[model samples]
Target: MRAAGRGGPVTRAAVLSAALAIVDRDGVEGLSMRRLAEAVGRDPMVIYRHVPNKAAVLDGVAEIVFAQLSVDVKDSDWTAQLRVIARDFRALALEHPHVVALLVTRPLATPLGQRPPAVVRPLEDILTLLTQAGFSGETALHIYRALFGFLYGHILNELQEVVERPEETDEVLRLGLHRLPVNEFPLLRELAPLLAHYDGAAELERGLDILLNGLAATL
Candidate 1:
């Protein structure tokens, strides 16, 4: 199973999917061209034929996760569409926590590699929403950046806690409430349990409402 040439013909998508599986199982550190080839049962050089190097392979993994976000933008209202997109994005990130670090660190640009077509429609949807909400192209771009940044930060923080303290729920709770002094931060202290709980979908909806509502006010 470890041998590179043990498998069959490999397509680019197959290779990327195999690489993502490796990351999902063992993390970004565990992924390599050779290992990916073995995972897909192909020649190591076969993977190189599809992606130039390990950097490209890592980028491909991110692209695969993005590809899973199959949002139907045309079928929904702008605000509802944005919330669904945000929720789906968060779900994908959480599902592939091992890729969270890389996804957060890299910008979605040509330098990282071209994103899959799956991202294009969702992105256009957000831009359309911003434009419909009275933002210029420049402002739409800023809003897109702000929304993604907030979602990514929130997901990454939650994932890091899950990874670093898998067996220590109390520790995770303590860390989450570290900023609060019990006496001075009574409300926060009282609500720490609720606050520490990370509900990606619910939070995405709430955040989207806040953003859209604020944008509506301005418009």
Candidate 2:
């Protein structure tokens, strides 16, 4: 896939897209310059020429994932905007479960932090929402932390579910119910069905509402 490097060489976007496809199929561990080269029908050296190394490749994947989120705070209500952002993020993570673990553990400052310009716009929108809601810069930062923590936690839990049990059986639900003594955890057992059900979008919207409402009351 080594395009002529004279005038306009292989664009970064093309390289990143190929990398994301690799991650989606083979996961972060399965990724390597050689594998990426084979997937893209390029020489391994050409892959390196576009991205400095494998770490950079992983970062590109993260950027690609974030780029998929569509949130516009200027056009939507602050709470509505935040809910959309959270939901979109949750969906993206779930779509690429293999990459979720890498995203959680990797520091943003690493390759991931070098996000494409498109990724920064969504964060700027979120920050703008927080400011409009009467939060100080510090408080806005804290809100951001809480918002992401909730999203990440939800995605991580979903990833665990996929890994531990590929099949969703009634027995799985019963095991969780058994952990809570019926006498002491009557409410929990009664609500087990709702609790066991996985709806990342709905849960994300609910959590966002709670977080924004809490922030509103505090502010």
> How far is each candidate from the true structure, as Cα RMSD in Å?
4.4, 4.3
User: Model 2 TM-score?
Assistant: 0.77
Estimate candidate 2's alpha-carbon lDDT, on a 0 to 1 scale: 0.69
Least accurate 10 contiguous residues by lDDT in model 2: 1-10
Query: For candidate 1, lDDT tens digit of each residue in 8-110?
Result: 5577778888888888899888888788877878667767898999887877777667667664635436556667777777777878889887666643545
Clashing pairs in 1: 7-41
In each prediction, how many residue pairs overlap at the backbone (N, C-alpha, C within less than 3 A)?
Answer: 1, 1
In order of appearance, the predictions have TM-scores of 0.76, 0.77
What would the TM-score be for candidate 1 when compared with the true structure?
0.76
The residue-level lDDT of candidate 1 at 6 comes to 52
Which tens-of-lDDT digit does each residue in 135-213 have in candidate 2?
7778877877788888888788766753233364664354466665679988777765666676766766677778889
